[model samples]
Target: MKYLIILSLIIGLSCSERTLLEDYVFDDNDISVVKHEILSSTVNQGYTLHKLNLTSLKWFNELLTNRPIWWHHVYVSVPDNLDSTRPIFYYIDDGRNNETESPSETAKLLSEFSTKCKCITVIQRQIPNQPIIFTADPKSKLRIEDDIIASTFGLFFFNRTLFPNNTYNNVPLLFPMTKAVKRGFDETVKFLKSKNVNFTEKFVVSGASKRGWTSWLITAVDQRVIATMPIVFDLLNWQKNLHIQFKSLGGGYTYATYDYFLVGLTAKLDTKEIREILKLVDPLFYLEKYSGRKFLLFSATEDQFFLPENTKAWWQDLSIQTNNQIYIKRLANVDHYLNQQSKLQIVSDIKVFMDLMHKETSSTRTLPILKWYFENNILFGATRIKLSNLGEFDSYTVTSYSAKTKDKTKIDFRVNYLLDKSFVDSNISWIEAPLIQSKKSDLAAVNEHVYRKLRILSIFNYVGFYLDVNLKLKDSNETLSISTDLNIIPEYYPIGDCYNEECLGKLV
Candidate 1:
């Protein structure tokens, strides 16, 4: 059954189980290497950057557009020590077909990471074949990024007829996007083998925004991905997170999420089809498959589209918590971009964490461990946070941002000036949090406030502050970060029948 399949393949997979993601299979023809060629190769920052053109397959023929042939701009960087046994870092990104095709952006971050990890790095672009004009209406165009995703949601989720002429309906934009990544990897391996290059076949995948969502989805289906770092796309447990946006943003999602709003997706969120769609896309259902995988649930504190508190919805729901390593890395005063005012962005340290991931199995460099200081409020939540392996760290610090406001009943952190880096610099500061000696021995306590014990049935701030615990590696400038759970002071919906919505509450 490895024949070419359409995006509508998902409709045939409507069963409500982990098998929703587990059972997805790409056709051999979908990932078949139609062509893969190295367009150019150059040395930059001590790494070889190879610009490659990969034409994987004819995704949807005579359906959405006349151009069914998928074209991908892939860049592979070779580290100093290229071994077939070492893991590879694959970053899935989105770009326009006509944009400046340069690998400088990936070089900026991955060069240092390549040196540290000594692994092959790859960046695949033009995820959805951008700047695409609708087949029916030539004027109706779609650009790269979330807008493409939103429109795709319109067609597949609601089965909207944007193009009146086409008989094709419910063709998902999700399937081909994932195929591009898997095929890119397949082609990369093919080209490498042609050049007598070696790869481990193991992958550590990372991507931002829509690509980040794809990263999670691809990992769900592809066991090749042993580690996944999905950046800034934190809306996991899709059904609940979507509704929480309404709760956190005062009964409406942020304007930045207008993409979802414009396509009438927000209206169908409560529908049965959308709920079924969430099962296929949400990474939560695929947690059991991630037992031995390493995960970095990367987040941005000032993200306009997603709330910081959204993580609470799914973090505790991760039944595989003990079976996997899930790190919550949050940056303060940064928005969806995760970069602001040349500020020391926390993502700069991601290279170190990734380096640690490679070493987890092969080298002596081990990742840090964290613990919850459960005194008496184990049921309410841990009162304090603890960082173990103190002797291995050079130093550490904690910072927090309060989502609370003057009204204890309301918590609104998405102010208008989130984009103005200077505004955050002057007004809202994720100030250094004070560390206290833990009640438990051999643990370093990292908490913002002078600990407050939660009594049974006692309500705290409508939404309290969340802490980011960062620890520096021994004798190096590199650092790793993990955050305490979002302090969502859950509230009841005035219009809806929802009740007792804990921070980790599940509507689905």
Candidate 2:
């Protein structure tokens, strides 16, 4: 028994000696910027837009035939009234590099955002440095986001059939991608300091889609990131996500996840290697390790890649770790490709959250507190919501409730009046089925023929219904939108059953 214990301890120490995925993320003890050039600078509306090209890393050794190096053309919009006290609103976005669009056109909107918010904005492009070719059993050209990630994951698996040569061994591409972001930020800071500008090192990290995924992981290892705004990427607790996404879609993966499915990455979902990978790469695994970190999870109800049922499985865990500091925003009637309105909505919403964080940093304010519950409605033969701390929300008057509910319940309030009057109401496509939309909208598009296909596919296969509370700041025009966790109906989907034998009851 003594020999066994000693041997186990030695093995554990050896495993701990292995370089963690986080170690690779900021692997910059040796790397230096190959080149950083300021291509152009423009002053627009109290913001200075500086376009820069920064080549940062030579990652892993080489993957089969592709170069291990990467570069990004960054756009940093500096607010003229820079507040040293506030955390920089750093947005990490992914789009085509500078070669695709003119520098002026690319930097315009973000520069406007900086001018309006009065905060520094940084956008790093070409994050994964794509168009990478890896020659395995079959040569594959990876450019799309998921294709890039899964292929590197394939290398980690040393999945011989996919990566026949396995020349790169098992170095993940994610590390290099994350390292690029950090390096870009470092270079930006150096550039600013060289130009005699100074501000806080703290940041509110944010990004959309795959960048959003990186935003979550960035906060995990980078304490400099004081808060995170992960948009359109609700992929926390990935093991459960894989199981639930499959189970909810009637035991099949969504077409949106084609890259992961194609690479046979989905095939390895149930394996021990994947579990080991999760320890290194999964965001939720690091949540407890870095508690009290602020998070605002922005999601879409009809996101093509992620289902609405997914959030409920992991939300309780998130709220607890963040001490209820985490908030949620679920845009209605939108797909993964967010519409123009949704895009503007996201920025407007984030602006309010940004102000909240700014004030909290100076100890002038704290995050709003609100609570809720469901009670049996005897008259309606259904459930009704009873808010616990309604008074805390600055403008959550009884008027916010629709006219139907106003007559049903004696509450005198005005969502329109308390906030701005011209609230842009969303179009609702309510099919009205089990575990689907629970609220009634004034403009319900109940045309089954016009929406029958969507109902057949989405309503039956997916559900994302939740109530939200909108609060006004004490004296600001900005409205804060925080969502309750998605309502989960046990029967709507098999929340308890581990239908897939490989899942082994990993369902949360």
C-alpha lDDT of all candidate models, in order: 0.63, 0.62
lDDT of 2: 0.62
Worst lDDT window (10 residues) for model 1? Answer: 499-508
lDDT measured at residue 228 in model 1 versus the true structure, 0 to 100: 84
| TM-score, model 1 to reference | 0.79
Q: Model 2: per-residue lDDT, tens digit, 1-508?
A: 9999999999778644534656666555547645689999888778788889888788654645365667777888888887766777777766654257454332356667886677788888776677676655264655557877777776677654544454233355666766777777688888888788778787888888888888887787776888899888888788888776655543455556666666565677777877877776777777664476888888876566776556766777877887767777777666677777887878887787787677664443456654433331222211233333222234432111111112211111111111132332223242222222222221122201101111222322232235555656555666777665454322244333243244432111
Backbone N/Cα/C clashes per model: 1, 3
TM-score, per-candidate, Cα-based: 0.79, 0.77
Local lDDT at 152 for model 2? 70
lDDT of 1: 0.63
Model 1, 318-391: lDDT tens per residue?
52553426777776667776554312343465567766665564534366666443234434433466555454
Q: What is the lDDT of residue 427 in candidate 1?
A: 35
